[model samples]
Target: MCVGDGILPPGPLSGAVGGKVKFNTTLSPPTKPFLSVSWTFKGVNIITSTSVNVTSPGHTNRITLDRATGALELRSLVLGDSGEYSVSIIQDGGQQTQGNTTLNVYEDISGASITGSDDVLIEGQSSTNLTCDATGSISTREWMKDGQPLQPSDRVTFFENNRMVSISPVNISDNGQYLCQLSNPFSFAEASYGLAVNYGPGAVTILGPATATVDTLVVLYCSARTFSPAAFTWFFNGLQKDVDEAGYVIEKASYSHSGNYTCRAFNDVIDKHATASYSMQIKGRLAQRDTGSQDRGQQGHQMTPTPTTSRAPGQRAPDAPDTPTTSDAPGQSK
Candidate 1:
């Protein structure tokens, strides 16, 4: 075979499976009006053309030849179609030219998966690592959170050519669904993961009456803001109470019930806790009304009435007037 002027500037070409490609041969101008051209793969004749007719194998129906330019076109390429393709051209008076090209065919991404620890992450206390695993030839990778693109910050980083992601000092806002996408020129695949972040019990509050009277019923409620619902505990005078619910009840408040009432809120996921307390006061039943009674009693003391006594039946009444017929004075006869 004789060498041509030169090969094309782009030496190699690539195509996806079931796609098309073209191999341009730098052919010199033929001196004669008629020329002979042939295309070969690894020294096997794939297509050949003479002045009279053209010939090709039965399976090469998708292959075509340009008689004037000597360029080869391949359609619906397969994995076995990837190889060196050469073209030879002959002119009158023994003039010859040749050119060669390499073709590459790649399969698409078929499947993908994600692998990492699914344990609970603590805010400002835990670290995590994740990896993306894909099948077939993947040329690119992308990461997303809750259907939005993931932007790297000081606490987030990527490694292993963007196949792995690392997170440090995780926070409560980082909880969401994460997606990993792998792609090639022909196909794409994706996988997902659910992330859970545990935070603290903050802003503890107790809701109840500040003051109560004796023999009155009262209920105290406790709550806090947290990622995980907090468990409640009631305390009286620094000692744990018998109740375990979020609400505490005093069936009958007495003077003994007056003390520092405290509520403790705790979260088991992050082992965080918060507390709130109220100095409760219990008063006597008559303490509030007695003040008004004393003020009215002092203003009407001068108008008090004389006291009278009641006598028993059959007994002479005290200071009773004597009848003329039944009684006699000391100076008169009866």
Candidate 2:
């Protein structure tokens, strides 16, 4: 207690460089008035009630002492000023009390940033090291990925006072925004980095119709899974086409469009390529598939009537004449 007990509990007070701090002793003028009030650092006199500092040249203009209240203020602090401090007050009635405390000075932190071992990070096959950097003293380092706390795992680790992190065998999921937070008793700072983990150009696929009629609109599409956009190359009948896109448009299909089309996908990061092909056929017209010859044969035979049998003139008309004659009437005797 820096008040009635006149003792500062020996607890350390925090301050940053180039800042000001007031050691509130909470003391007031004694009824008997005061004889002298003095402040000391590490057993050496720093300032007196008369505004005079002896022994420490750095505290010449930065120390203040109140004879009445026994309070002391320090200004324009520096790192070298950290240490044990004591204040003694004596009243005219010969009553004296002393207070003791500790001080911890820290340099303010700033310019926090993260640096990686390599400019480009690759997935599944590449290892990367990231180090957090700042200007002044830092006591703690925290890491975050996409706003979530990042913990050490089998593939992720921290070292060098947690100022650096190592990721081995980078994965596709590692791609995200990363942040590093640095802190100390007096200051805090943060920096961000975009972690790009390049992956594949695999699972190449082509989509389109297998057959299209002549003079029809035909469109073919291509796709693949990749971290970065993949470059596409189209091929017709094993020949490289002039187009390089995910879509191939044939607004008007013709005989020339009848061939096997291939789509090749390439990723520059992994330097790998994949391909898929589609077989397309074009006809002059859909009507060409109809059975025209069979239909014509049936029409040619329609003119002829059904077949009829003819007998020789002398052979006698079969089944008798149209009208039954008297001679041919029954089995009567002639």
Candidate 3:
């Protein structure tokens, strides 16, 4: 039968404090005539149902007996009411039917929570303790990290009734969500805590090109490895850039853009930072002298020089190669 509250699902019979319990004993049809019915708690007779009304001192108001079924119902249950109970019924000619039942009473687990230090957990540098606490009947307490059981190691230990977990020095591997589970024969409850272990801003790098041509756009990318997301700052020639993002852009490359660029990554929780530098040299395009040489070729520089010839009576000499146009390119002078 359903009580006021604090009842668990089907399994072991259980009751809550201030609720009710029942000794589910059904009487067999009378073979002859009913004689006496009695109920005992822990071998101490607490009630007797017959023509005469008899009951234990304090149990009179909280207990009821059904003479027809030999069933006993207990109300206003308390923790001390839990124990072994027995029922016996006697009929004419001294025939008796006896049975025993056990009752376990528990209050609902409530106000379960996990507490810990709020400071940042720096790898190899910080230590902290997490405690699980509650207000009700907690027969067993368990610790879990990220949905898995949390095992104790050299740096991890439990004390104070296994309600607290202490880590001597936190590390990157210890970063995860933690939980506390509390349970009893009749009730269950849990609480969770998110644990963050601050690690390094490591392996800083620039991902873009180290050189760009004049009058061309270029972008420089920076990155780092960290346990938590990090803030990035860019620097050009020892001066910090106005932009705080990981990508830096130069609309047009010029000689003034040639210098060393540095990237600095900072972790928010711990006192750690990482830096990397890339030197970029802005290069000019091919010289105008080279372009001029190409134009001269198209005009006449590629033609064979005319050969000198004597002419008489206003006749022109035949034009032929005397000496090809002299070349002045480096290593090609002739």
Candidate 4:
């Protein structure tokens, strides 16, 4: 209540780190033509001034005072320089005016990091939780995916003022790099995390001949598209075969080889598999036809003998001709 004429108002001031600020005070020049003004930080003298001269050895370059108004100016403020500041003005008649103000300096956020529950997400089987961490007076946060702002969907949720995010039942479309940006009035920082989605071995395809002749060679190929290459297995007639490669070969096809062939593609990363089947048919070789000409002697002449036909193995020869032959009627001949 003893403040000289209660001229200066009382309150606090705000400043940004590595920036400048001013603390204002109003005072009337003393009637005797002699006036003094002094500024103290946490009760330690920072600068002192009179009508004609000003002295602040420790803060000579960064601190200044207004001789007429008793205002204090500070340049390049730092976090350590934040505290209570007091200004006192003395008139030549021993009258004094004093006021105090609190200064708060805020620094920018630094060292931001983003973390997630799983680096590799499995499609339709995995859920992930993500968090953003940083240092400083942060006021707002934003999340981005694939260079675009992330919006909450049926399977995605946000928490902690958007500093944390949750993705449930992840799908193939959810795979990409994610970013977390932390910002304040004075500064901003960002962190990023890579998200991978492990998905199928779906839509298996089999390529091969559907039919083959006996003693002919055949090959069957199986494949599928997947995030991770799938392991292949071949099955024949409801039984597992010894072949594990994507390609199956039959050196020489036989009637016994005809059956339903199946290819199974499995991906371990996503624990998913697909199957495709093909029906194969094998046919036995056909018998060759015999082409021969029958000769009849002209005008009572005896018929000459015809050469016998050569038959393939396992083939039966045609029975002897039913008509009488010259050898059968030997007595009538000659």
Best by TM-score: 2
Q: Give stretches of model 4 more than 4 Å off.
A: 1-62, 68-72, 80-104, 118-121, 185-188, 208-219, 249-257, 270-272, 281-334
TM-score: the better of candidates 1 and 2: 2
Per-residue C-alpha lDDT of model 2 across residues 64-170, encoded as one tens digit per residue: 76556777789998888788888887778777888888887899899999998665677778898889999987889999999999889999999998899999988
Q: What are the TM-scores, per candidate, against the unseen true structure? A: 0.63, 0.71, 0.69, 0.58
- Deviation from native of the Cα of residue 330 in model 4, angstroms: 32
- Model 3 scores a TM of 0.69
- Give per-residue lDDT, candidate 1, residue 331: 91
Lowest-scoring 10 consecutive residues by lDDT in candidate 4? 290-299
**Residue 329 in model 2: lDDT:** 50
Candidate 2 CA-lDDT value: 0.83
* lDDT per model vs. reference: 0.81, 0.83, 0.82, 0.83
Considering lDDT, which of the candidate structures 1 and 4 is the better prediction for this target? Answer: 4
**Which regions of candidate 3 fall more than 4 Å away from where they truly are?**
1-12, 25-30, 33-35, 42-44, 87-101, 149-162, 227-245, 286-334
Residue-by-residue lDDT tens digits, candidate 4, 187-270: 899999988888888889999988888999999999897888899999999999999999999999999999999999999876
